[model samples]
Target: MPVKTENAEQLSRADREARGKDAQAVAPLESNAEFTPGPSRDPVGLLLEQEKTRVPELLPVRHGRMLVSPFTFYRGAALPMAADLATTPTSGLRVQLCGDAHLSNFGAFASPARRLVFDVNDFDETLPGPFEWDVKRLAASLAVAGRENGFTAKARRKIILAGAESYRTAMRAFAEQPFLAVWYAHLDVEDAIAQFRSQMKKKRVKATEKMVAKAHTEDSTKALRKLTTQANGQRRIISDPPLIEPVEQLFPDVRVDAIYKLLREVLGKYQRTLQSDRKHLLEQFTLVQVARKVVGVGSVGTRCWIALMDAGDGTEPLFLQPKEAQASALAAYCGRSPYASHGERVVAGQLLMQAESDIFLGWTHVTGPDGVDRDYYVRQLKDWKFSFPIEQMIPSGMAAYAQMCGWSLARAHARSGDRITLASYLGGSDQFAQAIADFAETYADQNDRDYAAFQAAAKDGRVQTTTDI
Candidate 1:
């Protein structure tokens, strides 16, 4: 799957550009305009297989969440789409992929500099793969979301074209720059607001600004206020049943003290993975309480824990989310990851793909309550993380958001893959964008059919779902 031109040292700039152009003859740009499911395709079966490694109780919760809508299903259906993408045409220009590069996966987060920067925020399924695979996933996500929002076909197509074209044009521009320039490029959230504010109505502009303001307040202090309560004079995470269960609730038979003791030891080891400065900073904070948390739809069944840490003074708090990392969905279709730990694989991919990353980003191995060894990556629970409520978004707003995602993705790909090669392959036209739009509509139709089949399976009890969770 990675049989593309990856070694820049072996090829001249002209030769790399020629290689990209020559790929068009092998797999024409327009060849991406169709979607045909293989006869053996069983979306439900694929989903079930993926859920096997997850916690049994949370399986129902995952299915229930995915059962919400086609768009919601698509959000948690990265594995199925990875299977589909493996069958698609490619130009063989490989890059570090946000293998689950759906619309909801792109957003703004606090950079190391404390500035809000937009980037591909989720990388649980990140791996090296054909660059267009991420592009198509992003485009198709917009189509799915548009349909859910009641956008007409013409509107959805226009949004998809805008996004795909943005990627092409951005890549072309990056191809002309020096390596450091491409590496340093980032979309500042404030700049993004400025760029799109004029295109929106006055009311919409105010709402957007309000959203940005809200993100700034979504840090550990906010989590401390919202998710914790005074329990026996200690600030402990509230037990919100399946959504947020204290570790004591999760393993009643096991001693809660013993679990915390082990976790503290694990964190002691995990801190070693960080830089000396970060490790020193972490030493100031002491692990306080931990809760088993249910996160995103696809990751619901995976082991996720919200760890509460206090800086001894008990005035300042730090919340970290330790999410279990499994083998990427692309690993089966592509080759197995070079890294021994899936957690490291995810962190490696994120560092390569994002212009700025969390300062506390690190990985560690943990033995679960069930006695199973699993890899996990840890990051701030929330640090000015930003996500849009696209349900209220209009078509023009979506078009603007799409361009931002496209440009950010291109920047990421340019840093890891060959910018010159991709620029040459995409050329100075919208032919590829048109093809992506065509494929988006076609694949979105397939997603609709699969979503319906999943609904039927749920009705027949082929899959159990507990929406109350």
Candidate 2:
């Protein structure tokens, strides 16, 4: 089927509803075909190919992290999964997709309003794609995670269904609201806690409150205290080796002065991407140190650097992370991003899909020491951000968390997609939810197979890994 590119504003709400109903003729709501690896394609090869675009030395660390579990491998295998999702059935409605919208990708972060808000926190793989693609990926993640956690199949199915249902119901609610209202709708931490308290037992609610309190303390000041130290009357980033090492330590042959100059130039360019007020706020701090920090499974091999800055009086500290951005995993299937710079692409997508964003979010392009031009987006190192403890998740708790993830994702799509049409397509039924449940189960099986293949490759010396990066 040809992709649907019609703008939501081109049709009346009723007309959009009719258009959505037309979609069922192409693909039924409950039809979930199993994932079969393409006859000529190799999942392992696809993974190894992505490594070519990353810092070569860190590739082993990336593999090591992914080797931990099938769930972690899933996190790093967005490209392989995107290739498969392109072959699956879609609802034909596009959105600013969190292209790797797994359960862990949704988390709590402090918004510009200084309120802790819950939403999709990662955007490295973000792009425009069918809304169902995100929903399916999220559902499948829950299934994989449930298996890893040893939940019964029946219990996993319930969680998937609950998540799908939450998305459908939330989309329906957003569809009824005015466009501006839908654009502004957000779930702050306090609001999240209240909703959970009403539905959750006392024990879970207390645990949640404690988690929220901890997240609040994870701001820039806290990070500064933990990751920096005074060296010759200057605060410098403490090298923890492999995980958090100074750039000079990793690249001893390279001139440190040249790297610092290039970074300063890149930071200046990035400042122009921000709003006038944010740019002014940033000017108060001067850069003191920069360190390459390996972060996340999928992003482990990427050149992620943390820069520390301080006010002239040494009273205020600011931490900014300038992480490399590459072509989104979705770009190959959907289309090249409209923005020239991939960093700009990431920043633009985040601003569009998120109700509120980090005040310092911006992008820049730089030529690295390797002579390769790279794109990077910069933002505060930590702004009271934290994710829930998935290890402690019970079936019932997962069900609740899944619902929140679904609701959050739906709200994000509603802002950048046609919620009215999505609502009409879903149409107050369980068919779509059931379809997602089916897809989740099947995809979870596929993940297991892929993980086994990866493990075998590692054992045979086809892949390399270390205990810690």
Candidate 3:
């Protein structure tokens, strides 16, 4: 389970270059190849299998969300993509991957340093894999999303190619920097704005700024107002069945005192995983309420809970989300995680790839009344976070967004992989970019076919959906 690196430090730049060139023998460049569906491959069956581990009641909600469009379907279909990617060509260079590196997964969030930074925020499927796997997934997503945004097929190809080029150039830059400098590299909000301003229209710049302003308003205190209300002069989470409900309401059979006691024990264990200062800081808050909350399309069926805490002062609040962490979709294809719990696996991967992370980030195991053990990673909820709105995307806007994703992803890989080798393999040519563009186009077509199949399944009653909100 040791992380893969080529002992690349021993090689001179030229040697690394040669090694990169040698990779072409194993996997040729410029061949983005087609996907011929495997005779036994049933995408719907695969999705059904994934649902087995999810909360049974939420399965319909998950399916309903993914039914929105091909883009959303692509978002939730990471498992199938992982399977397909395993059959694709590789240069045999491995890195810690953001296994579901679709465009939507890149977003802006406040770092622990209190600076707004853009990075890959989702790590549910992260694992060690061929570096190209991430790039291909990203490229394909751009194509799918761009089509959804009404971009021409030709225009979408350009966006994918442009993103691949950005990744190649950014990786090369990181390869030349001092190791410590590369480790410290991060794209703060100002850096992000400046880059976008240089490459985008004024209108888009203003729009991005507006989005950033909106993100600043999302935090625990704000969440308290929206999701909680005073009960007997104390704050309690509001109950809205299906979407948000008290744990007691969801599990009516369980004693409320027992639920609180179990959570207190879990929180105590979670605190031990934090640094001393963070642990001390957490001691200031008192947990008051807990509720089950549904999250994103892909994450819908997972057991996610939000805790409301009083920050000692009556008016202030702290909210923490303990999201269930299952074994990564990439785990089976790559290898099992070395960490004892999937929660720990997620925490380790996030800390390694992000330049800055949640100060409260930690992991613990929780056993339900059924004697089932579930791993969860805890972090502050909605502490300044927002995603780019795909509805507003235009070809030019998409190109800029793609570049940002490419740059952010490269920085993540640089932190965990052999940078020099990766950059060298990318080379000083457009061959890689063109190849990825071709791959993106072909894979996007495959995604549409899968999405159609999904739609048909739902229509045929093979897939259930929940539309009631």
* Worst ten in a row by lDDT for model 2: 1-10
Task: Report the alpha-carbon TM-score of model 3 versus the true structure.
Answer: 0.97
Deviation from native of the Cα of residue 77 in model 2, angstroms: 0.9
Q: What lDDT score goes with residue 268 in model 2?
A: 96
Candidate 3, residues 1-469: lDDT per residue as tens digits? 3365756777788887777778777777764444556777788888899888899999999999999999999999999998888778788888888889999998888987788998899988888888899999999999999888889888998899889999999999999998899889888876778867877888888888888898999998899999988888888899987899898898789899998999999999999999999999999999898999999889999999999887775577889999999988887788898888899888888888888888999999999877899999999888898898976888988898899899989989988888887887888898989989988888998999999999999999999997665
Q: Report how far off residue 311 is in candidate 2 (Å).
A: 1.7
TM-score of each: 0.98, 0.97, 0.97
Question: What tens-digit string does per-residue lDDT give for candidate 1 at 114-170?
Answer: 888899999999888899899999999999999999999999999999899999999
Is 1 or 2 the stronger prediction by lDDT? 1
Clashing pairs in 2: none
TM-score of 1: 0.98
Identify the leading candidate in terms of TM-score.
1
C-alpha RMSD in Å of predicted model 2 compared with the true structure: 2.0
